[model samples]
Target: MNDSLHTVSLIKIALYSAFAFVLSVITVVFITPFFPESAHDFLRFLAEVGIVLAVSLFIVRHLNKKDVSLRSIVGDTSVSKKMLLFSSSLTIGKLILYFLFAGLVLRFFITQPEFAADAQSVMEDTSPPEFNRWLIISTVVLAPVIEEFIFRGIILNKWAEKSSNTRALIISSLLFGLLHIGSFIIPQFIGGLLYGIVYIKTKKLIYPILMHVLNNLIPVGIMLIPAPESTEAFSVSQLIAELTPVLNVVSLVFIIALPVFLFIVYRYSRNLNDEVAPFKFNTRKAI
Candidate 1:
């Protein structure tokens, strides 16, 4: 505990993440032997309770830490038009960045032979109707709630108290990305960065949580769109050209609109003083 808060928070993040993942894996291993596939799948979902439980523990421990309390996560969230405008613009900005990074990876970096497995895995993840529904719900709903609380609420909150908000953003975002395997890590990290910034500027947990949910929904929405059935097979590049013209258009618009969004964010962030204390109890905080 004498260590720098950033260091301490980082270690705790790794420990709890590993604990949850190992427990989930163990649960899957145990259930695979005794239960049918569907039953095991459902049990696997419950295994995620380990993460939820672990996060709850983090919340308590973090709150009890000296000079820190619950205020790090919760803040003023007035339902005024100004707040709504900031939220909407922040949400769309994050989405644009999300697609920008993802498209860059797909269009250029993923073309390498080394990434063939990664690319193939992405394509093969084509959704079945019912399972995709549950998957979307889990990713878009459960994930945002659980993850925003854990990353933005607990990890970033703790770090912000211990360090500057900028450090908190970078550290927590890196940890967020590392939670995933393979190519997922980069985009997830980028998302964590944007989410953390929004949480800092608005001091509103809902904005980041909403952004997380929206980010997840992007991929799911893409999957749900019925692809035009074709007899001829296409290479990844050709398929990208065919299926994702909208992504390119959006990326272009994102480039054009990014400065405008930043101006709006800056206007809102005029009073975002990082030196202010981060975690404390406030009974009537707006955000």
Candidate 2:
């Protein structure tokens, strides 16, 4: 087995994820209660930063032992204006399609009250106002950097050493989806796949991170929008129930349009070599 693949095996990836989850639980269960409620969010944010740092240090230490610098795995490819625009457009189109399909499936196919409630629970973020700042910071900033580094930079590249890039992409993206399993699994899975593709095409972590930021920013921006006073407290289920008819029509349109949109994405992805990769980066050793 190659050194990179051996160092970052699937076992290590699972351990990394488990370590983060256990640490988070420890923070919430043990640490958060001691703090006044006002300080909980700040504490959680610090915990998140610590988790990222801890995981990163572990990865770096292992890779160094293998003589592989993190930067090489991350790649030093410079993203050009043209590649940036192309990647951004592709991400936006896929996101719109995902939103439509998700709405359709939830509103129409999944009709049992129990199942619907479970789905709604996944979508709902009931964090109080005190936590909003940290939530936003984590989602918009910490998430993209750490997640992209772990999934695309370390896991995907390491797996690609011993397996085909396609297999590595599927494995990395599947793990990514599971990380957000309860909350719109399909969309997260699709986003993972898209980010994986961007990483593969450009050989750069920055590209996928940029796309992830854009993906996350959309929901963050939506959350920031002031709702109508009357419906401010409505949960996703209630809102969906109220707008069922309109959503059904929109879903129908999306169902019809989805195939065409997918075809465009496929074509664009195939032509990415022409759009990106006109330049290259000399890989020097760096963490």
Candidate 3:
């Protein structure tokens, strides 16, 4: 494709992503309030997913019409299997690292000692009847798939087109981090960085999806595990105190293991360029 055409395609993608983001925000803030709390939450989640997917699909279609595709965005596919393996490994490694980070931060650095107090408060406040089932669907399935499609698929794709790989990765990752501007901001930002690195290394959406799914799943799984009851009303400090001892040991183990895992992933991904070249070409041709 010509530079002019590529520029046009990129503009379309940016417009679509921006539109989806705005729509999602509006849905969450206003449209979601009419239904029952649980129903509203579920619907809002679905709406957000829909917006991203719809926008991404539109961009893909636009690209296809101009005879471009993922291949054009990613270029040649060599070592895809290796890339996949490395990506999966990196996802696991990062999860371990982040979990440990979250634990340690809660254990020591967080002034109030309620490491994820805000998240905990939201979860408690939004407790639904089938909380476990809903939580699994939202975290493991919905969040991972949809968020990856939006951040890695549309946003990163556009960034890669307009800038160097390093720039694209950093900008997209920063956007990912900033989007999670809530009480759990630090941990989410760390998670975003990990996901962005995997996306850039693999040039495939699946890696980030797996990483995101695991990131959400681990926390929800921990929440599912039974905990001792305290008579006092839940306070952030109290919650941190309850989990501090267990978190410290878990964090230490994960922190130790993460670097080893990351090294393996890095080594594996080094061979990916050659493997992905053919696949990328074929995909471009098909488009």
Taking the tens digit of each residue's C-alpha lDDT, what string does model 1 give over 1-287?
12123423546656776777787888678768888766765666666656667766775675467334344445554555675566666776767766675665455544466665665677666665555344456678888887887787767766766676778778889988987647568867867877877677656787778778777777678777877765675566665556466656655766777677667666665555443423332322323
Candidate with top lDDT is 2
Report the candidate with higher lDDT, 1 versus 2.
2
The TM-score ranking, best first, is 2, 1, 3
The local lDDT score (0 to 100) that residue 272 gets in candidate 2 is 42
lDDT of 2 by residue, 81-169 (tens): 99899788877877787778777876665566676677577657555443268878889888998888888877776666666667777
Q: RMSD, each candidate, Å? A: 5.6, 5.5, 6.0
* Local accuracy of candidate 3 as per-residue lDDT tens digits, 64-101: 67655455444333456766665656566666677677
- 162, model 3: CA deviation in Å? 4.6
> lDDT score of model 3?
0.62
lDDT of each: 0.65, 0.73, 0.62
Model 1: runs farther than 4 Å from truth? 1-17, 61-72, 76-78, 100-133, 181-184, 230-287
Q: Candidate 3: where is the Cα deviation over 4 Å?
A: 1-5, 8-38, 70-86, 109-138, 154-158, 161-163, 183-203, 228-255, 258-287
By summed lDDT, the worst window of 10 consecutive residues in model 1 runs over 277-286
Instruction: Name the candidate, 1 or 2, with the larger TM-score value.
Output: 2
